[model samples]
Target: MRRDDRENWRRVSRRRFIRLTGATLSLAPFIPLHASAAAKARIGVLKFGTVSWELDTITHHGFDRENGVELDITYFAGEDATNVAMLAGDLDIIVTDWLWVSRQRAAGEDITLIPYSSAVGAIMVKEASPIRAVTDLTGRKIGVAGGPIDKSWLLLQAFCQRDHGIDLAAQNDIVFGAPPLISEKAMQGELDAVLNFWHFCARLEARGFRRLIGTNDAAMALGAKGPVSALGYVFHEDWARANPQAIEGFARASAQAKKLLATSDAEWLRLAPIVKAEGTELEKLRDRYREGIPTRPVAEEEADAAKLYLVLAQVGGQRLVGQSPEMAPGTFWEGMPK
Candidate 1:
């Protein structure tokens, strides 16, 4: 997004939202584009992820209203659905990867990335399991979330190559599946180890799984100098230009929500009903939040994100995003409201 496009969005009053809803007063499922001139932009979110947590916070606390926009959040079951919705013009912004934006721009899709969430993943196993390290898993069946081309999985391969002198893809019986399956297989003893995303890694830990390698160490293993942001908000350049305030408000309110998460564990408990998360999951959530989320929205070390990109480009290959060595230029958006 351009600097000149970062105008202030007009905040929509609760009265206007009610009026727009016409007595039923619903907040989701059907937010009209011209509703109340509050700079509406539909946001598609995954059932899980940092944006889901933050967006839920923003809406429940009216942070979006304070920041000057009306957010209509649509929940998607998978990342592919979210990306597809963005391409179909059904969603204005969705939490995705810069890598995907690189691929889309290569296809002439006009997608651009803005910083969103960053956390480290892990290769975890049962506490009592004989698998004490990534190197020990030479013949083990490892469950990998997001599959072979997953950025984290690619990073794991990079780590193995640099540190262990072996090909992870060629060595283990890698099962590519969802995050939940990582826990399920690990618990069932069907998988000796599993590589899960940060949030899910926390859940696996809460369930008594031990980390063979954590995110920071995993980054080192993958050849990054430090922690980096792999996920972000993806947008259409044309839509972002036309409704600058909408884009700015989303990022601004999200920053506020990130700050809220950093400051209050009580606030974390408050989000359970909204995100439909509860119990032990809350503790796991706290673990991920405390150790995974950054003090600022952008990673403290900018070089970290670049090192991550290099690993993904070199290791992820054509399977991940179809772009290699060169990511699309101007993918990062610097138009957040001051």
Candidate 2:
């Protein structure tokens, strides 16, 4: 009763312990070894902005999750509103031109830029218009989107003055208005030529408007060796430095999204509604977007930006470039993944 029964009980207990241990080990693969704590990045973007396209792709494909970050997006009605939100510490990131980032940095904000898109507007005319060249714009009524100090407008002026020896600002009847308004006026034949943002230009081009000159070409004429990203992701330098892993993950996720968009026509097809384009308009938008993806090194981009900055400053004056005649140091975030 003592020895044999005790032996049997010990043997059964040992078998039960082994079975439970095996079960636990088998279930371990399904359980999280460590709780997920992905970094949170609050980004502000315009409601209908192109940046939304990439953000959508990143989220839809789980690129952000794959890179160990979580994106919290806020949509704004206007670029100024997004900028204000960023300044008020409501947002950690926003899409804007590096020039604006430079201005902010110069004013002690310590913001930095990461390249986004190089696509810019073009000088477009109706199919039958006689405006064959930049010089032909003389005495013509030109509708300029983004106002007098728009980087595109200033680049156009700089190009004309440098290459054609004509001051376009003085020679042409310039009409400043919103991008959609300018496009509408151009469509109605009220404007002899229109310089609108790339998306508007794509829409106009789909409707048979001819591109007289692209701002990229103008940028080249003004001394940029390659495509220069006019717009980029802007964020506070202190915030980026404190969250290096999150920022780097974001950069990689962004790059992966761009690569997907660049190579996959299927992605563009999915983005058609967001882009508000179709057929020729969609094709133009897709092609232009692919063309704008940054290919050169950061140093090269910064160098070209410096040269373009001088040209912009010459035309846009202190109002456009702010207190800094040159791009502020560390305007482009060097921590970006290669």
Query: Which prediction has the highest lDDT against the true structure?
Result: 2
Poorest stretch of ten by lDDT in candidate 1: 3-12
What C-alpha lDDT values do all the predictions have? 0.76, 0.90
Instruction: Report how far off residue 53 is in candidate 1 (Å).
Output: 2.0
Which ranges in model 1 have alpha carbons more than 4 Å from their true place?
A: 1-37, 48-50, 221-223, 274-280, 295-303
Provide the TM-score for each candidate, comma-separated.
0.82, 0.90
| lDDT by residue (tens digit), candidate 2, 10-50 | 99999999999999999978876323767889999999888
lDDT per residue for candidate 1 within 1-338, as digits (tens), equals 55444432223465567687775646454776435567888989887656777887888788898767998889988888999899999999998877788778877888877666567688898888888777798978888887778777777787788888878888878888878877788888899888888878777777788788865676765555555667778898889899988888887888788888888888888887764567787777776775655445343334455567777777767777674466666566655455
How many clashes show up per model?
A: 0, 0
RMSD of 1: 12.4
Best by TM-score: 2
